[model samples]
Target: MFLPNPDAEFTGSYERCGLTLKEYQELIKLSLDSRTFLVKQSKQSAFAKLDLYGFKDEMVFLSGSSDNIELLHEIMADYGEDVNQWYQPFTSRIRHIRAMKSQSQYHTQTQTDVFEIA
Candidate 1:
């Protein structure tokens, strides 16, 4: 049996928690939209800076989850005007502090010439 309240949070009563199912759905949608909008803006900002960095032999670094790195790679390739951009920075940032300790100096020197923190 499936009871659909459309506004039911978990059971029939969202009021128990001082909320309604519709409100919960709205909140979730808002959060997702916020995240999506931010990502879009970030990418746009990154792309805008692409011309400043140039797409020559300059090496770029990225640090993030494999999925994010992959997506970033795609973004840089298609919209960043450069396909050789390396995702090493994104991967390196995820490394443990101790692991990055030694590589930090050398990595920073060899990694991105111009990049944004966001």
Candidate 2:
């Protein structure tokens, strides 16, 4: 998830993730291609849902249930590269989102004061 600032010089590799510039570009291209396929399939399948939060700054954000996320990983794996290397950072973000959702549900279920007394 780390990227050099727009004003920073290109060092030829991303130090945080150990990906070369070429590899990063390839990862983005593959992700976009796979997203297109997944969107089409999600539209056709009643049980699957995918939401794309378009790229902002240096990241592309996608939101989906665990099943849909797994489907994306499967498709990415089919592209013949080790998906773990390419997707490690994103998987952690997904886990964060899941935790947030669960916390939200817990708060909603344990509601106490609906109004404040003056």
Q: What does candidate 2's lDDT look like per residue over 42-108, in tens digits? A: 2131112233555431232333557756745775665545665646555555567668999999999
TM-score of each: 0.20, 0.28
Best by lDDT: 2
For the record, the alpha-carbon RMSD of candidate 1 to the native fold, in angstroms, is 18.6
lDDT of candidate 1 over 65-90, digit per residue (tens): 46555656665565564444434443
- Against the hidden true structure, what lDDT does model 1 obtain? 0.41
Clashes found in each candidate (C-alpha, N, C closer than 3 A): 6, 0
Best candidate, TM-score? 2
Candidate 2's TM-score reads 0.28
